[model samples]
Target: MQVSREEILHIADLADLNIEEEKIDKYLLNLQDILNFANIVNKQDVSNLEITIGSNEAKNVFRKDEVKVFENTESLLENAPKKEQNMFKIPKVIN
Candidate 1:
């Protein structure tokens, strides 16, 4: 899992990153650590693991929709800046 300076520069170029000269060593160490961790993960055995397409406890919690007229219609229209025919009047948007 040894990452070279050339590989680091290539990765930086691919990611469009401008790594400072002093920070190149830091990037090289971090990239090598990531590669080492990936190698460790690739060595794991998961052949008997079940393939889950969906959750076991998943269920719809939606309530049934109901429509009812408001009791205080005049009070709702009182806060509107412009009212016309008991509806809020807004500026015309389309020409």
Candidate 2:
């Protein structure tokens, strides 16, 4: 597949990208290479293969959940730079 400079410019405009004039040719060549590689992959024969979405093997691999004692609040908050009423205080992140 051939990707032209005009097509690249149109795609950039649609995607809100500001591609410099000097880089347009390189971008067009790279896009064409990617399309060519995709074409090659599309021609591969996989008609007899089973459709597997994930790994074929499964294993039991989860830790058992149980109640456990944690350190006191004062000890837990000792490393925090800011704390208020046994809770860690962080800078406001949302408007």
* Candidate 1, 45-80: lDDT as tens digits: 877887666777666689769887799989999999
Tens-digit lDDT track of model 2 for 1-95? 77777888899999999999898888888888889878976798988887766686556678989888785868889988999888899989999
How does each model score on lDDT? 0.87, 0.85
> Using Cα atoms with residue i matched to residue i, what is each candidate's TM-score against the true structure?
0.44, 0.45
TM-score of 2: 0.45
- How close to the true structure is residue 13 of candidate 1, measured as C-alpha lDDT? 93
Q: lDDT (0-100) at residue 30 of candidate 2? A: 86
Task: Report the lDDT of model 2 for residue 4.
Answer: 76
Model 2 whole-model lDDT (C-alpha atoms): 0.85
- Give the Å error, residue 69, model 1: 32
Q: Mind sharing the TM-score for model 1?
A: 0.44
Q: What is the lDDT of residue 10 in candidate 1?
A: 89
